[model samples]
Target: MSGPKEPLTRESLEPVPIQVFDDHMVLRPPNRLKERSAKRARTDDGGDRTVISRAENALKLLSQEFDAWMTKELDRLEEARRTLASAPSDAAADRFYRSAHDLRGQAATFGFPIAGLIADGLCIVLERKSEISDPTPLIDFHVESIRAVVRQNVREPDDSIGLALVDRLAVMRERALPA
Candidate 1:
């Protein structure tokens, strides 16, 4: 043979090694194409080993603040209910809706997902404020449902009563929707 043999195995079908071309051995660049282009694996810092409990305590304190705020809102809701029962006007509806809407928006943040659901139900029912002829009972029921949740300290999504309340609200919303 006039030249060095070319490897002919099926595995040898790949392009010639960049390190070896013809009779000349090529010097590889210190930084390789693959090494330069490859991404390094990532791992999370996983954060402070000692302060975790402290952080949890801080969260508990914050949650207590939210709980207090929610309690005050519920009290306001009771007043709004009385007001609506006395005079069901857009102005009164606006106050009631704001209370419900505020609770719906914030209750979940303080570990009261069911309260949020019931409040959301009230918000939905009271949406067409002027259209509702007699919304006091429905509003009172939703407000009381949320109050029951807080009273029982019910937070689990699958809690039996909570689920029933959520289902009822879903049905109410569905019924209210235009078919």
Candidate 2:
């Protein structure tokens, strides 16, 4: 042992800089296909014409069925609204929410973008549990507006009446929910 032990102090300590060793290595696997096959797979337009044609045909078939599907969804929403109006229960509320949410998701796909917007507004109104008190009238209005959009085939988001209806619904929702 030394004659006297020196007390360790900050001045006596040596500072060492941290060295971060990054072992990360990115490995990009090479393409295994032969060049001729790869070139043949892509068309001059940069897309496979056969795939594009198949997709278009599928879209046409879905479009042909879209009207019926939209009508079915609207009917389901209406039924749920009626159930909620008649008997306000958690199950009914959940059903109504599910129906409205389905419409919100599918309306645009069914070529009724305006209806989707209306469904979205209805969902917003219904989401605030604290604000919900006898919201049957508001629900009715939303259902009717959606029906009108589908009935008139208001597919364009920019349609004057559709825009006006959406704006009016927004005002109504704010008035009803107050936030």
lDDT of 1 by residue, 87-144 (tens): 8777887887788889999888878888888888888787853455555566567778
TM-scores of all candidate predictions against the true structure: 0.61, 0.70
RMSD of every candidate to native, in Å, equals 18.2, 17.0
lDDT of each model, Cα atoms only?
0.76, 0.85
lDDT for residue 105 in candidate 1, whole number 0-100:
90
**TM-score, prediction 2:** 0.70
- Minimum summed lDDT over a 10-residue window in model 2 is located at 27-36
Judged by whole-model lDDT over C-alpha atoms, candidate 1 comes out at 0.76
Query: Residue 124 in candidate 2 has what lDDT?
Result: 84
Regions more than 4 Å wrong, model 1: 1-58, 129-133, 176-178
- In candidate 2, position 106 carries an lDDT of 92
